[model samples]
Target: MQETLFCLRVGHRLPYSMSYSNTTDFTNPSTFILLGIPGLEAAHVWLSIPFCTMYVAAVLGNFTILFIVKREPRLHAPMYYFICMLAITDLVLSTSMLPKMLSIFWFNSREIDFSACLTQMYFIHCFSVMESGILVAMAFDRYIAICDPLKHSTTLANPMVAKIGLAVVLRSAMLILPYPLLTRQWPYCKSNIIPDTHCMHIAVVKLACADTRISSYYGLFVLFCVKGLDMFFVALSYTQILRAIFRLPTKDARLKTFGTCSSHLFSILAFFIPALFSSLTYRFGQNVPLHFRVLIGNVNLLVPPMLNPITYGVRTKQIRDRLHQLFSHKDI
Candidate 1:
């Protein structure tokens, strides 16, 4: 009776279905059905409204940062350069996930082709790593400016800074390119249902029937090597920056130092805290609630892009003032 029901629900035979079976045998499943967003049905307009709003806001916020940095002559500096890179990264990163997510929400058609899935995974990883590298570059720039003020011009001169920026882009691109290629090569015999909305490395990997030990190791290695190392450098740079700030003679100078580092620090925490939680959840999957997992995953993807511009605008007087001036001039 159970077998009959399973076959009926699966729409023919168990072998062609993407649904998972309780039995030990894993060979029956072909594709995976992503249990779309927890409580929101695909056709619910109300549920998708918030996601649409976020997507629009994320794009506009980051794009405005890019525009301001490009148009404002005063913003044409090492700091803004890194910020623009960050904005660009956020734009690409959010874009890679949001459209597909919205489609799933609005249409209820969560059936992403295998190739599309791979492409989405590739870009998501690429832009995410790029954001991490750009943040590290921003921290390093602050470190040099605070710790070595006299040589700031020489240390971060146009040619040198440009080269560094290029290197950051190149490194992130190369590091993330291998994962998609490797995953696509593996044979997938298990159910294709990706539990999450987006194509995450862990969720996609877990769908494989073959041993994913190597892929898991690779994911860990990249996490530690890229995100972990970037965090370490950011911490060290901030430590030196703090020491330098304390040595400043005037209260104004001290305040200036704090103001300069504050945004970067906030941005760092925003990016890392959720990431650490996601990694922890990934490692120990048993006890966590599904909704919490979904929430964390969405935050991990969304917050960095949205918070980045806000952080800079709030913390940097120059950016804030420039924004005001730009809007005021446009009003005239």
Candidate 2:
């Protein structure tokens, strides 16, 4: 069955109006109008408040994690290194969309340059893929530490960590490179108005006059290859970690060991669950309200960045201790 395309008309209050004519050769409009949550424009102001707060929190939290990790000698380990990478990825992922989205909500600054939109699309998806890979790396770090304590240091040396980081970067960049390239080639003559806040891949590509099956299929392929493989490895690592924890000599030892993994487990759930749900909902939930769908999309990107640092700060003893010491010294 062919996917049904829904064309949204810009409301009268929008600064720029959209033309839904049947023309097929416009290729690239100079600017694409972003309609921030169709049918809920009136609440845009109120909505911006929470969105802005989350963006601010995300920035501050991630930067704090990076600062603490960098300043403390004890944190110069494989796990902390991966944590820093995750923080950076979260920052990029949230920053890519929140500012522009806040502008749309607060000032009606909804017009995005075509090329710029594609660039934003690329960054958002690319970093999201990187985040997934980093999560897997973090999980591997946990597995090595718990299951193979004696060789953990030798197995995940600085050189090995560098290699893992390089692989994650190259993998995401190479896989998501095709999205903008493929999207740019299509003729977007159908409409210049995107129904949601950001230039999501499908949302942007669907506007093109040409068949979008190629982009859609490639998207699925990347989704499976990156996120799918990452999830599988993470699950396998944790499974082994769990078995090791159980075989420990005593109950207290089991609890103590599991505590170390609790933070990573929380971060994984926080990152992937909403992300997968939002993507699936956007693609298949035809009966879902536009506002609800858009809100989920924003939440997946916004919430994880803000939540990850907080989760680590509270759960990781070393980070919490460093945070306390750093602040206490300032108070003196």
- Per-residue lDDT tens digits for candidate 1, residues 1-332, read 35435445433333332333422354433334444455444234665676667767778888888888887888888888888888888889988987877776677666676767877888888888888888888899999888987888888888887898889888878888877777787666545656567888888888777888888888888889889998999899999999999999999999978888889889999988898788779668669876568668777888888888888877788888888888788641
- Model 2 reaches what TM-score against the true structure? 0.94
Question: Candidate 1 local accuracy as lDDT?
Answer: 0.77
Candidate 1: Cα lDDT at 217: 88
Model 2 stretches with alpha carbons more than 4 Å out: 1-24, 330-332
User: What is the clash count for each candidate, in the order shown?
Assistant: 5, 0
**Clash-forming residue pairs, model 2:** none
lDDT of each: 0.77, 0.88
Query: Candidate 2, residues 137-220: lDDT per residue as tens digits?
Result: 999999999999999999999999999999999999999999999999898766677889999998898788888899999988
What's the distance in Å from true for residue 295, model 1?
1.6
lDDT of 1 at 41: 45
